[model samples]
Target: MAVRNADISVRRGEVIAITGQSGSGKSSLLYCLAGVLPVARGEVRFDGRVLGALDDEELSALRRERFGFVFQYGELLPELTVEENTALPLRLAGQRKGEALATAGAVLSRLGLGELRQRRPSQVSGGQSQRVAVARALVHQPAVVFADEPTGSLDSANATAVLEEFLTLARSQGTAVVLVTHDADVAGRADTHYRMRDGMLAPFTRDAS
Candidate 1:
């Protein structure tokens, strides 16, 4: 199925929510924007940089340096401690072990996971593990964060906690957040919202009688 063209701009320190039913092209839009999927048409830009013009290597570098991603699943390494998992991106960027771990420590602290840094993913609760995923994504201090169903597996309270943390981090660090979710409560928390239907996205509107 062909995905529809979307022209969207997200500024610093704002949270933008993308909501749609399953198979509505929400995830496809994200993948296209992130350069994970090739765009047959249309263009994506970030902070004035044209994404479509970049080669794969260039896109990878840009993504590494300028973007963070949180998948629905934690995607943590089984053998790594929370701290190690959180430090992966920094390490990938060529920071020394000490520096990467330090950065991870700070991010974990910010996410309220400092006390559990030494534990493995299997040793923590689902919510705590997901928090570690959030820390990992933010450790590199990217300009934009893309999250796909970030709270999809959590309980109500846990989902709320994670959503609030995402908003707080974006606000405090001046990072732009683009989140994909089916949850209305999660969508409602965003600064701006868009809903996808039949492969097109439109601004969310509420009826006031």
Candidate 2:
């Protein structure tokens, strides 16, 4: 099994972090919790609703409406402008273009990307592109955000800046954040920290050696 008996919970506006070595099943646990992967046993619940009980359409709708994701690579569509990419989630959730764009613009501004809204992802620096990705994940104000290696590609300075902005915005809006990374410094910033080893998940502390 990639992940075994992993169990955890997060509250509104709280930040949770999982740190583990490569192939230790950290991503597997994150995907299961996000409903992106099926649980072979046990279950995942969101807002009192069992994720396994929902049909695919229902699950898709739920995710689109209430969840967000950030990846190590930013994953912004190169063909789309920064603002358009940020607005994509709201658009997919049925918001009007005008309103979605306006909302996206606002988020981009808050993330210090207002002036670059019209630029494409390829036109920005790695740090700027990552910030745009953060803006996209947050534009919809989802109840939860799942981030995997969100800052693994950047230098320490850029990583710190992006993470600070990401958490500040999420916390301000009462959104829960689940982050997976191998960086101990990053994990230490979370309200709760867990370490995965050989497919098992367990609580972590600074004193743990």
Best by lDDT: 2
At residue 21, candidate 2 shows an lDDT of 86
Q: What is the clash count for each candidate, in the order shown?
A: 0, 0
For this target, which candidate reaches the highest TM-score against the unseen true structure?
2
Off by over 4 Å in 2: 207-209
Candidate 2's residue-wise lDDT over 1-209, tens digit each?
A: 38998989989999999988899999999999999999998999999999999999999998899999999999999999999999999999999999999999999999999999999998999999999999899889999999999999999999999999999999999999999999988988899999998999999956652
lDDT of 1: 0.88
Query: What would the per-residue lDDT of candidate 1 be over residues 83-198, giving only the tens digit for each residue?
Result: 99999999888899998999899889988889998999999999988889888888887898899999999999999998888778777888889999999999999999998887
lDDT of each prediction vs. the true structure? 0.88, 0.94
User: Which window of 10 residues has the lowest lDDT sum in candidate 1?
Assistant: 200-209
CA error at residue 138 for candidate 2, angstroms: 0.9
